[model samples]
Target: MSEGTAISDASASRAASSSAPLAERYAEAMIPVFGTPQRVLVRGEGCRVWDDAGRAYLDLLGGIAVNALGHGHPALVDALAKQAPQLAHVSNFFATEPQIELAETLLSLAGAPQGSGVFFANSGTEANEAAFKLARRHGGAERPRILALENSFHGRTMGALALTSKAAYREPFAPLPGGVEFIPSGDTAALEAALAPRDVAAVVAEPIQGEAGVRPLDPAYLRALREATRDTGTLLILDEVQTGIGRTGSWFAHQGVEGVVPDAMTLAKGLGGGFPIGAMIAFGPEVRGLLTAGQHGTTFGGNPLGAAVALAVLGTIREDGLLEHVRTLGESFAARVLALGDPRITEVRGAGLLRGIGLAEPIAPQVAAAALEAGFIVNAPDPSTIRIAPPLVITDQELGSFADALPALLDAAAPAAAGAAAPVDPSAAPAADDKDPS
Candidate 1:
């Protein structure tokens, strides 16, 4: 039998055994924000996972770039186990040592001084909220307008949502915070014109646009932003929520760029190494003091439990030299992918562990489904963009396995574009294998 036939058979079996019942349970209990749960994953370990049915998968998506150290890393598990037993919950009325230390460590990594401060939150959106508040408060009357890029994604909260450029996402939640303007990313002239009035509070951008299919900004454009913001005293906010913590093979994506020290930056996702935590790092005092004692607070933002987990994650990244690992592994991974010599791939773009494979056709969803059937986990940002943000600690051997499986995945996902028409939607398209994992 053909390989496609094998994949279809496997899909059929999984559907018949447990996938159907689990999907039905999800339909009854969960909101459809993310559609049905693609797989009922039950447990995971170092770049791999097992679904509820005991099938294993190489998790290349890394929990959407949240599992920097990968799932069930000893550091994170031990930290959580130790901290949870000692002190898990504490209100924001008091401060914690771990929080303060984590803040200082993050600042140091960002090339900021000792006096730099951080505001902790539970997720990237909340961290962005803190950064937004500080930016607006510091802008005063000079410029309250924030210039964002089109096709950029910050987060989903009301405040962050306003800065998000996707219409479908923003249309449902109207009346977002005012004074946010959209501009074409990497267009220096357009950015200058948008900020020329000096009425813009800050220019917010993702060093690498994660949600928009791993699009990266031009270095020259970033330098121009630095100069323009300085000329008009506008703040530059880099939302590194998905790009930071070694996912980019660097501490921060803007680190090597000249003359671009952002006033405020938001980080989350991989910061806690799979634990729930977020942070807003403010630099240069322009907007650090904008939030007063009671101006902003989160009840469980920097509690002992989260701080402990964050510290462990950071410590491991440093001690294990994951930055170097990401740099080396990412280069090899990208090179291997490029060598696939597949015509369907339009382009590949990324910094380090976080990358996107742009397909010539709108078959990303299909590609992802096919990959899942092959015991690999990946995500499609849009119909043509396949996002590949694996764990920062992912090994070359694991990536090699994925490299071998990828051609088959792309062929199955976009057979029509490759001269064969698919019989159904890619997401629901039946695979050929009925028993094989890969």
Candidate 2:
């Protein structure tokens, strides 16, 4: 189809659905991967989004940490507008300036040593998939085993899925690529035992396991992991998909821990400020040389448009000092939630904007629903964990609004939770395990 014809057809589809309930239209026209989106968002402007009914919501979830600058920020908008007309996409056979510049900036931010490199993809799962390939190539015939943390989330693609430890997301797809094992996260002895055989190719983990209820691994544990992996010749790959690009008040979440650097790092979510970009950075010469040329590639991986937008996001974060702002506001916001003295709220777990509000009972779903009804956006990653990873540019007032309404939201949810929440299974393990606040 011609470009103009395709545009017209899309516009016609929008017009046909103008009067219909978007939820019904969505159900009819789309697959239910996400089990029916809660709201049909029409548009957004800096920390707020509007539904089809014209109701506005404070977007505390920030598109699940993809909208680093919130919505429709001028810098991001300008970058997209400028880049699209100039040069949007090019085949991987030819390189673009934006792609080169973006890769360079990422390498610098990561503090990767000389001979480091980056491979770009279009989403979090794709980035993890690339990292998976890198791991396999490095392992080759000598080391075939891979280690991932229990309850950790990486991504959903086949290769990435193999590394993810969530049973629900993995069970249906098996038998996945073998030689991947789940070990207890943060248990030094378990990790040591896993590596003692010297057959494990790599260990993949998230600095903050966002989908596992925004849980942040201990810095000391991370340091030990790095040391042990180095000693054993295993690659330490940190999945920073949700916590990178100032989400956790740092360029990368692990940067908060001194003298700790992974052999490979995967990034996505907020990297392009919602522009659908992902990257895998290989540190040092040996790791960088893993996948030579034809071993792996993607058609849309390093498109100029995505690279330009990501550069804009990084530049904006640095220029506006959103890192420090995120740190200060996140601390204050967590404190405010705790100070509310609501019994339903157990404690806030995580750092910076990436946080999970621990609950006394399995009422997180009801609470998230209540928050949505009360014009705030949040989510329940698990039965007892309310995960909130708002935009880095979100202000004190924006967050304060949610905190002020949280008590009432909880009150609204109490009745529903009492009737609808699943009873805690005494024999089964807790879904969240309180997410280890310490």
Candidate 3:
């Protein structure tokens, strides 16, 4: 059959056996925030997944960096299976051992100072919600503003949305919490000016803006924010939701970058390896007492199932030395892709497994579609930026497969859609960096 005929047949077959009825059910039952489903992923394993149609894909996006251990790792599976049969959940009124253990583990990894406290939530958005509330508790009547960076993404919840810098995400939900100001990321002058107001509660930033396509803030800028916030009695909140858990080849992206320490930090995404969990870890004694017993809580936060799964993911990352693995694999993967020397690839930027390939032309969406047809899964954050945050456990062989396929993917995305073309100016007009400040 002809290529066009085959394509039409596949479309018709998909429509005939469609999940559109379920989609219609969702349309009526759910809010139209995310729009139509992209793909109905049925099952996943380490570094790979299949759609409802059973099309195999090399999962390079890692569920947007949430599946740190990939899908269905033995350790995570065992933890969940064992914990579910034993005790799945309990009320927040009663403490659970897994919750406490996970809390201690997160606090320890964060390296918070003594008397630090932690609050658990179910998603990155909720983690930021707790952080926002904690910041407010610290600010009280004196300071109420939060200084965030432009081009930042911090989830869609009301408080987190308020802190996010994008007008498109925040404007639709108007009258959000006030006293928030936006500044250009890495712009020392703007950050200083914004935080200089004694009425500011905190300056929240992601060490590397993940949803904005893995843009890392300069070490010097982070250090400066720490000092600037300190001078004005404001708090420094680092939203490590996407950059944490070995995503940036570090236990935490902020570590070893600069001699800077945030007063509080929020983590999620890769934290649970797939299971949903999020945490807010407050450092030192500054905000420890800010929240009393009756201040805040979550019913499903830190449930035994999630906590147990997270514990296993953390242990596996340590025991398997996934951090060093991510560091090495990331460097090699990046080098190979950059060496592709594709004209459309103007620049490549990332840390560890989370990287973004910037295209000279607006063709990332097409490139991603091409990649899917090629049996790989990748994501396009913008028309010009292809974001890759593969599982930290992705093997070298898998990385090579992607590297081998990349030149073809780029060719398929470029003008002729085949064979290598002459390299374009690497210094071509580049897309502006997407910064996340929450």
Candidate 4:
């Protein structure tokens, strides 16, 4: 063949090889846990991601609130690159500088007392698992029961799953760790009644119920909970996995509720800025020593790489003043979307960067689909709610673009009639693996 013919043939061969459908490949090689892959994302920068097909999309969900600094941030990348070769993985028996510094940093950020302690884990579920064990130890044998709020989500691990109130998520894993009770969220009376028995080990709550469509616990109710738990001597564990790390315009969501300090708080998601790290921070002397040395542990929980990345994330959030930026931008975004008056929108909820757009009808899935088609990524956490958790580093220009497109997106997703059922989506059913909190 001639040189030109050879070049053309090579190009065609490469194209043919690359043409295999990614979804088909995924189905063949991986379990159908998350249903079909929405899109084969290949690259990301700032607040944008590109699919294997080379389509660019503005990432508004931020990897379900895990991407605090946005994709491929220089600080996180630099920290990880620098630490990886130095001392990436170290056993708990050995101490690493990054781990100690990150722990101290987290405690200071949390305003924990002098006697506070921290336990590192690999994910949000593990963090909650550690906190669960702490509560168990603190409560001792006599106090066996635990109390969690209705419509709350902690994590998906068996121990954390027991604390989660969604029946659908918990029932399948049936006969979970026992002695857990679910009370109506934000009902101080119900909380009081549940703790009145004094048999409760801990009262676990999420300052904002992210999985239940971004419902925030009333500040007053949270304060009441603090008092109730204090009176009953029950540990109060706040699952800040989805709301911590400045996702809610603060170091932690519970801080918004004045005078309410949790006995223990689980941190993850934004921590490590997408590198997968989790921590259980215990405050006050009472609960600090509950988890003894041999009581709990992990292989790669506080590895140097993850610790360095977390330090970089926390440092950037402080130095860059992203917390205030998130506060201002979040309020503006919510107000602008609500002002569109699309009639289809009922309300806007949540604080800081974590937002939920409530629709008049059950059209969130359709709205999310429409948004995706429009080059935006969002989450339909429930049938009636669209969760928007863009990265804290997102610029005003990006927020403005999304705000301008909100009305059109909602219009495209409008329901057929007043009481008509939501359009059925074949893939909406539960997958082999449980769904993660949005």
lDDT of 1 by residue, 1-438 (tens): 999999999877666765456767677657788877888887887888878777777888998999989989999999999988888987887777887788878888888854568889999999988888887887777777888899989889999999999999999889899889899998888988887776888888998998898988888988888889888988888999998888888888887577778878899999988888999988865467678888898987888898999889889999999999998888888888889888887777988888898888898888887778777888999889889899988888887777766777776766745667544323322222223242
Model 1 alpha-carbon drift over 4 Å, by segment: 1-20, 416-438
Better of 1 and 2 by TM-score: 2
Candidate 2's residue-wise lDDT over 34-122, tens digit each?
89788888888888887877777778899999999999999999999999999999999999999999999999999999999999999
Cα deviation at 374, candidate 3, in Å, is 1.1
lDDT of candidate 3 over 1-438, digit per residue (tens): 999999999888767655566555566557887888766677777777766666667788898999999988999999999999999999988988999999898888878888998888999999999988888998888887888888788889999999898788888899999878888999998887776658888889998887776678888998998899989999899998989888988888898576788988888999999889999888987687877888899999999999999999999999999999999998998888888777767777878998998888887877786776666778888778889998998888877777667767776666534343324222221121211111
| TM-scores of the candidates in the order shown | 0.90, 0.92, 0.88, 0.91
lDDT of 1: 0.83
Candidate 2 segments whose C-alpha is farther than 4 A from its true place: 1-19, 420-438
Predicted structure with the largest TM-score when compared to the true one: 2
TM-score: model 4 vs. ground truth: 0.91
User: Rank order by lDDT, top first?
Assistant: 2, 4, 1, 3
- Cα distance off (Å), candidate 3, residue 56: 0.3
Runs in model 3 with CA error above 4 Å? 1-31, 415-438
List the pairs of residues colliding in candidate 2: none
* Candidate with best lDDT: 2
RMSD of each: 8.7, 7.4, 9.2, 8.2
lDDT of 4 by residue, 1-438 (tens): 999999999888767756578866677668786898888888888888878777777889999999999999999999988999899998888999999999999999999999998889999999999988988897778899999988988888899999999888999999899988899988888888898889899999999999999999999999999999999999999999999999989999999878999999999999988998999999977688787778899999989999999999999999999999999999998888888877878988999999999988888887787777677899899999999998899987787777777766766566532344334332321111211112
